[model samples]
Target chain A: MLLVILELVGIAVFAASGALAAVRARLDVFGVTVLALATALGGGVIRDVLLGVHPPTSLTKWPYLLVPALTGLLVFSFHPQVARLRRAVQLLDAIGLGLFVTGGTSTALALGAPPYTACLIGMTTGIGGGAMRDVLLREIPLVLRREIYAVAALLGCLVVAGGSVLGLPEGPVALAGSALVVAVRLLALWRRWNAPVAHGLDA
Target chain B: MLLVILELVGIAVFAASGALAAVRARLDVFGVTVLALATALGGGVIRDVLLGVHPPTSLTKWPYLLVPALTGLLVFSFHPQVARLRRAVQLLDAIGLGLFVTGGTSTALALGAPPYTACLIGMTTGIGGGAMRDVLLREIPLVLRREIYAVAALLGCLVVAGGSVLGLPEGPVALAGSALVVAVRLLALWRRWNAPVAHGLDA
Candidate 1:
């Protein structure tokens, strides 16, 4: 139940981000729907593929597709109202990222993936969809640049793994990891956090 | 031998298209490589997954990953010269699509897929990469609205199936199908053809 609720929340938040990004790119309704779908379900699709699960959730479930479309419509209809809630949107996005990372790690662990792989999955789960959406929108991926985004997800995964070793209850462990991620993201945003970029290609 | 040649030609054409599209979208070198990979290999990945093939070609072969990057660099360096040969690009793309459709259908048939399914697979094989590239680029799938794009593939598939029934030589049948598709595509382009947007969504 917790998983389902949090997953839906994450979808909604990501969908909003996707819609906003499409608007920034001057995309029409069709473009908006496609971007929202990528942002809302891309991470899950990648995780499922890596786990050898076929027909990932986005393709198998029509609701998963519809939810993003609805969110796109909402974003379009209430653009002005949403603009006024910029801080709220940022806070919700942080919460969504936290939940996604914890969910990815916990699910990978449950499925018997190793700690390192779980951490990678956790980070991907938080940011993969966003990265794909940005790439599709022809924008640089947020996680690969100056967002402090994927790092937060990585730290959340570490927290969860450590808590499990300490015999923490599953609920608290998940909650605590998620809280840490959210705190890091919010703090980073407040501080104008950024990753370093250099000239030319990297080794 | 034919299948391998056809697949290579299809990959090369799709890579060129991907590079051109990325450049038009104002993406840098890295972004062009990403688009090229998606455009040249995405359909095969989808087909392999649906057919339960593991470790999709893009992941299995370093060459498959590297070739697109090289193509991107080449295009980036010689874009002006390449752009002057746009007609040649279209002709190559048409030939590639015809061969890919036949190859895809024959493979599906050999794998015990029914005739109808085999034909559909053929069409998928021909246009799947471009569709995926457009989707990833946040554009309406080129196959979805482009002039007789899917139909051209479908015609080639039907010819292959029909030739088998008529006991025609495989080489002649394939040549005939390729010629037919190229003719149709050329005529469509000359006439400024397009598929009807049946749903009639508001602009």
Candidate 2:
């Protein structure tokens, strides 16, 4: 039940981010909806596909699809108000990242994927949607640029994988992993932390 | 046997286009290689995943992985010379698009997908890699922007699905479908045919 709530919240927050990006790009309504759906569900769909799960749950489940659509509509209608709360949106995005990374890692492990693959998929799941959103908006992905986003995801994955290896209970392990990601991401934001750029390539 | 050859050819041509795009973006060698691999195998991998095939043949098969890597290296070293034959490269890209579309549609049909779903998957397979390449390079996807590219792919998919519905032999059906796509795409190029953009949004 908690996981389900987390999943919905993550989808809503991610969808909002996507809708904001679309507004920034001055996209039409259709474009806004497409970006919202892609941002909220693209990562999970990719992960499910990688795990050989057909008809990705996001596509088949009504709530998963509806949440993003509604979120997009809401954002489209009230973007000016939403834009003023950008800091809150960023915090929500960080929380979404944590939720998604933990959920992805646990799901991959349950499906019998190797630990390394699970970790990779977890990180991908946490970052893939935003990357797709940025790509569609014709911007370099933020995960590949500023902040410790991918690193935080990687840490979450590591925590989950390590806990599984140590025979930890699934519930506690997932909670710990998610908390770690959220904490790290929040700290990074608080400190204005940025990933190091390649030497001589900082322009 | 025929499919294998066609797949390799498609990968090579797609990788070449990706490499050229990376060059145009002034990306480093690592970026070029990454783009090449993504462009060459991204579509097929997405198709396989959607079909419930795990690990994707491209990742498991040595030759499949090697072909794109080698293509990237070759382009990185000889791009100036290769860039001179722009017309030839464009022709090869058309061939690759046709091959991938027919191949993807047939594969989806063989997997027992409905005709509509198969056609959608086929079009996705034909354009997914190039879209990913463009996204990675921070450009709007060409398929979504200009030309009769996606239309050509959709037509190929329709031909394949229609042939399957008629219970035609797979080999002949695939051949005819691919040939149609290549012919249409080449003609579009020669005639400078482009999909109409929304008025007042052409920038």
Candidate 3:
């Protein structure tokens, strides 16, 4: 299916970002692969576990592991080419984020998740890997502190859900949803937008 | 009651180690507390989640959070005194490791886990926090290499299981197991001992 191809492309992009980050941090080959695996599959693993699906999609399939490992290895071998196009990497990352959020939302919805829960899962699926990567790297996560990260995922989820409720075809719905998320993220990054900082008594 | 005390002591010692490591890592106050919390309670959290226990014990008990947070704050304020005796910290860490392994193994056994699974859980309970810390710090885990490491936990689990099958009182059995692990780790450290390495396979 076209959707499946899009999903795989998204995964490859996400995994490459993880590998690139590890390389930038001076991690070895093993570490690069580990980070890529975590970044590409971490969100889905958490979602599956919470949904009570044992063995998870990653463990149930070989491509899930092989793809990320290969992506990391490839990125590591060709770091110079990738490093020169930082902007291109960011654009790909945003596109991957959009695709993943749509996939996660629709998957949860099809599995009979409540709307709010589906929305949460979708957002978590979109940003969870990046959060895990940042935590492991001892850095404040950019999504949590800087941009409209989870918000973009949520918007994508809303668009997909809205289209589904109107009996739209999944392909167009997913495409629209992904485009919305990618556009919002690109705009937010360009404008240096951020969520409001909480005051001393906010909590 | 003694076992409970030992568990609490283990938590406290690990909390201290977490705080010290956070300080050394140059984290902020909140970051220090977060590190301390993960170091002190992360193993139990993973155990409870894997066992399908809802609202893990660490969340149910306020002291579990309070103690580690307070420990981090204290260390943040008085780093000089704590840093003066690094050996004392190492000793406490070893004692905590013994208690954690013994406690986790017995808990798993009591919960009807198989012996090998119980032993694995025991090792995880003892070193899970440090492993998490290392992973988060973007390095190979110390537990995976160097010193006696997981061997201490494995030996302790054997003792605990053997004593339990022999109808020994839980108290004496746990105490003996804990002592054995502490002694093994101490002697190993004193002799600069390590598990055998396969050439070209350290990675």
Which has the greatest DockQ? Answer: 2
Q: DockQ, in order, for the candidates?
A: 0.09, 0.17, 0.07
- Candidate 1 deviant stretches above 4 angstroms: A193-203, B1-38, B46-52, B55-128, B131-203
DockQ, computed on Cα atoms, for candidate 1: 0.09
lDDT of 2: 0.86
Candidate 1 structure quality by residue, lDDT tens digits, A1-203: 86787888888899988877776665555456556767888788777767665445455555676787799778766665775799998998899899888988888877888877887888888889888777776667877786688788988999887766677887889999999999999999999988877767765
For each candidate, give its TM-score against the true structure. Answer: 0.63, 0.62, 0.59
Q: Is candidate 1 or candidate 2 better by DockQ?
A: 2
Model 1 chain B: worst 10 consecutive residues (lDDT sum): B194-203
- Place model 3 in a CAPRI quality band: incorrect
Best by lDDT: 2
Q: Give residue A128's lDDT in candidate 2 (0 to 100).
A: 85
Q: On residues B1-203, what C-alpha lDDT tens digit does candidate 1 reach at each position?
A: 76566677777788888988888888998888888888888777766664446777557977677776788788877888888899998887787788777877666666666555566556667777887778667775665446677667878989987876677777788778878888888888889876432121233
Please, what are the lDDT tens digits per residue for candidate 3 over residues B1-203?
A: 66777788888888888888888889899888888889989887765654445777778988788887898898888978999878888888889999988888788778766555566567667887777767655655566445776678778988887877777887788889899999998888889876543222222
Off by over 4 Å in 2: A1-45, A52-110, A114-123, A126-130, A142-203, B49-62, B195-203
The Cα RMSD across the true interface for model 1 is 7.6
lDDT of 2 by residue, A95-132 (tens): 89988999999898998876766876787788889988
How accurate locally is residue A12 in candidate 2, as Cα lDDT from 0 to 100? 97
List per-prediction Cα lDDT, in the order shown: 0.77, 0.86, 0.79
If chain B of candidate 1 is superposed on the true chain B, what is its TM-score? 0.87
Q: What is the TM-score of candidate 1? A: 0.63
